[model samples]
Target: MNESYKIISSSILFWFSQKKWFVYSILISIFLLNLNTPLGLTVPAYHSLIILLLVFMLVTFEPIPFPAIALLTLVLQVVLGVAPPNVVASSFMNDAVLFVMGSLMFAIAIVHQGLDIRLAKLIIKIFGKSKRMFLAGLMTISAVLSSFLGEHTVIAIMLPIGLSVIKNIDTQQADGKNAVLLTLFSIAYGTIIGSIGTPSGGARNVIMINYLQEFSNVSIDYWKWMKHAYPILMIQLVVAYFVLQFTFPSSLNNIKMRGFKKNVVKIDVKKNINHLFSCLIIIGIVSSWFAFNDIYGLGIIALAGALTFMIFGMISWEEINKNTNWGVILLFAATISLGFQINETGASSWLVLKFNELLATFPSNSMDVSWSIMAVLSGLTANFFTSSATVSLIGPLAIELHPTDISFALSSAIASGFSFLTVISSPTAMIIYSTGLVSTKIFFKVGILMFCISIIILYLMSQFYWVML
Candidate 1:
């Protein structure tokens, strides 16, 4: 008895001294919070989702590494029985994960052999010869590429080129903000614009399509997606240019990146006809996304491109190993599984129940008044819960309560664009923010302004394109 007592006292002291007690206590609390769901305590599904979300948010901002977040996500999922080993393992194979990895592989190849920079220089030489011209040219090029390819991929490939251009330009000291703001806004707005290009341009766009096709009558295909999204994308590009002009007005007269372009072009890069062939591969893959809707999906095709890039010796297998962020891949999978949980555990319905009640009172004086009110509020909520997941939770409710209110559903859906509230808002935002160039607060400030302006634009757009005419 005495020896056991002494052992217990030593363990208690060690636990307290090492701060393990607090850690264990929190784990125990979470365990207990989730444990009662099976016993009829009626623990909210969103309660679990909220806990996971809080943990994800904290990990996102913490000094801890992203790999650590990946690890904790799985361990916590298992402990809470949110996902088991088999379920968590399956998350690793999510279509979004495959898409992300495949896209990154393509990005790696472009970044590696200097093709991306070569393309950028060729673009600048063709359209640019002056400062304002160069800026406009850059924005135009970024918008064009982002719309077709992917936004994060566009940023990864072009940011270095942009930075190098800035380095060469002898800007006046006072214009530093203009330079930084222009470059950053070019990336942010360009990316947002890019996402509107295709369903696959942004992950959320794909998710939105799935929601519509699955839950509603509109089964949008790739061409149909572009028909709706392209108009919005083009308008966004025009508005973004004006916004940038208002935000940063500079007159350097001459913008010479001649040396930069020459350096980019003349360099002896890893020459391969394979680079040219990769375009064919991409085209075939994309064509499959449209043409073979009866067959396998695009993720397989994209992943095949990545593999084919290696198998054909266009890129080395070692290169793929170096570029892939497996941690992020895992986190995406975990979040996807979490999305399922949030839906399955009655969390999504519960959330919609409450949010629908809130959406019920939009200070309606007229149809336009009610529409605009719902638009702004839905857009704002998108900033917090994310455009995809928020729409996932609230989409059905919006459709059901106001089935005829296309303006309401469409604004609420397209308002998915307002995910710039924080670094944690979207995969693209997270991808860029993980880079050290920007901060969470800076994104929030710029994003909030962008969102406010965009809310008005979306309201206007609903009148023209998506609203009940």
Candidate 2:
């Protein structure tokens, strides 16, 4: 009887410990809900703020799965009388959410086609001779591929290749450790730097585009976005190469890569036809996005690409369903809805007003200063939370601050992709850290340097390049 009582008591204690953060989040939200704001916020606006804070904590701490948090967020809105059922349901779907879903599907199709093997052969062919040139080549390939294929996909493809290279290294030598670190970081930093190049590169870009359109009615097409962001991407890639080289300098001049054959394998006629068709389909979809995004929208074009692959028998639904991260999509949708609420309920405006008052004490209150401040803050916040979450939380205020200037909003969103401080900052970072070769100290040492460089470059682009455009 006593043992049975202990088991019951332990089970209860375990449950409470597991759910303590959830309880705290609920209690804090309730307390804030009851309070009156001096900023003249409406009850719904205050409720939105409470929800935002709760979600921010939950997402950061991850007390439960993110998808569950997203669903709970929607449920709590109705249960707490924050919004109606129809309104909450409507918020769950949007062009941005569809774009993310379709993009993931398309990415899965591309990966399933085994293009990474072809890419690896090409990379080995190009930069297999010299160590320095190989490092540069890896970074260049990673960045360029990530710009089009998305950072996560590029990282997923490149990580194994990097690890293979590290595994072949002689760790007994003194310079061996540095070589391994350099190789891994080359892929990581490249993927990160390139994610800012285009909308397809990262989810944050899509979320920002949607927010800009919904809130400010500013429409930026695919080519236009690439035109604005690609230059910054190019410069950052060069900077990243230098940064990695300087931080983790390798004394080895050349690496003898084993297990990589120089001879090309001849493909069968049927496989060749499929490869050609897949390439053509990808080109067609991307070209359409560039040429006709204003007419059909990016989301539709992306979905069309995935459908094309499925119809052609190049990919299967099972592959996409198993590989896709629906939780991220749900989290993104929830945050976007909350962002809209922040705008509609005047919470964003109030927060912007408070920020403006704080800025009034500064020596200069110019738009440039405002843009710089927002970019830095967003960049810093992104290193802790996901970039999508940072953008969703800060985007409303950015738009409210410069309601007419789309440049400010675009710059802030792009800058937030500079997640260089921690392994958890971005998936690319996490992937690199998984190799177990990169110590946190080395990651931070290199990351802090790159972060400083990125901020400076972003600030300069905002002032000079964006002004001309």
Candidate 3:
């Protein structure tokens, strides 16, 4: 009997230990729900904020699976009277969510066609003569591809290339190790900087676009987004190239080309036809996004791309389904729904009021001061939380901050791409860390430098450059 009691006690303790955050979140929610609603905020708005807090905890600690958290977010909206069932359901799925789904499917189709290998070989052909040129070429190509293909997709493709280059190098020596680190970081950072170049580059950009249209009635098409953002991407690529060089000083001037050559398969015409066709489909889709996105919407156009890929037998539905992270899609939809409710219930405006009050104490309402605060907060939050989540939560508040100045919205979205501070911050960072060769200490050190520089660049652009546009 005593043994049985100890076993049961131990099992209970283990469960508590594993689910402590979950328990804490629920307890806090209950406590907050019982408290009097704050001044200047409606009950529903206050409750929505409470749900938002719960989501941050659950997402950060991850004591529950993402699907469960997603379901809870939806359920809380209806149960806590945050929104009606129909309203919640409608907001749960929209163009922003559709864009995310379509992009993920498109990425799967693009990656499965082995185009990444072709692109990797192309990089070698162009930049193999010099180490600096090779790194710059790798980063530049990665940025351009990820600008349209999405950062995670580009990273998946480029990581192997980066790895193959450093595989034969003797890492026991300092220069060799630095060479490896530099190559891997170049690919990761390239994808990151590139993710802000176009609307489809990252889900966060789409979320911001969606909020802008929904709340502010402002429409920014694909090309317009690229116009506002591509210059920043170009400048960031140059800065990041130098940052990586300085952060990881390495001399691979005498490295051979055999490693890259060995990794790339010989191209045959018959086989290469499929590659060419795949490229055409991507081009068609991007063109559609540029031309008809205002009419058909980015989501439908993106989905059409995936549909075309399937029709041509480039990839199977089973493969796309298996590869997609449905939970993330669901969670994103929930956060977006919550964002709508926050705006609908005036929580976002309330936030803007408080934010402005905080800034009012500073004596200067210059664009730089206000813009810097939003950028820093957005960047720091993005580095800790996922970028999409940061935008879903923060986008509405940003738009409300300066209803006339779209630069606030644009800068907030752009700054969220500064995901250099942590491994879990972005998929590119996580992919590099998964190799187990990168030191967290070194990664953090470089990330801090990059984050600060990125903020400065963004501030300058917003003040001098973005105004021109």
What lDDT tens digits, residue by residue, belong to model 2 across residues 112-159?
Answer: 776655666678789877668877888989988787768877888777
- Whose TM-score is greatest here? 3
lDDT of 1 at 181: 55
Q: Write the per-residue lDDT of candidate 3 for residues 267-373, one digit (tens) a residue.
A: 78866899999999999998888888899988888889899999988899999999998999999999999999999999998888887778878877655677888
Give the distance in Å from residue 263's predicted Cα in candidate 3 to where it truly belongs: 3.1
Please state the error at residue 295 of candidate 2 in Å: 2.0
Better by TM-score, candidate 3 or 1: 3
What C-alpha lDDT values do all the predictions have?
0.61, 0.81, 0.89
> Could you report the Cα RMSD, in angstroms, for every candidate shown?
5.7, 2.1, 1.4
How does model 2 score by TM-score? 0.94
Worst 10 residues of 1 by lDDT: 35-44
**Which of the two, 2 or 3, has more TM-score?**
3
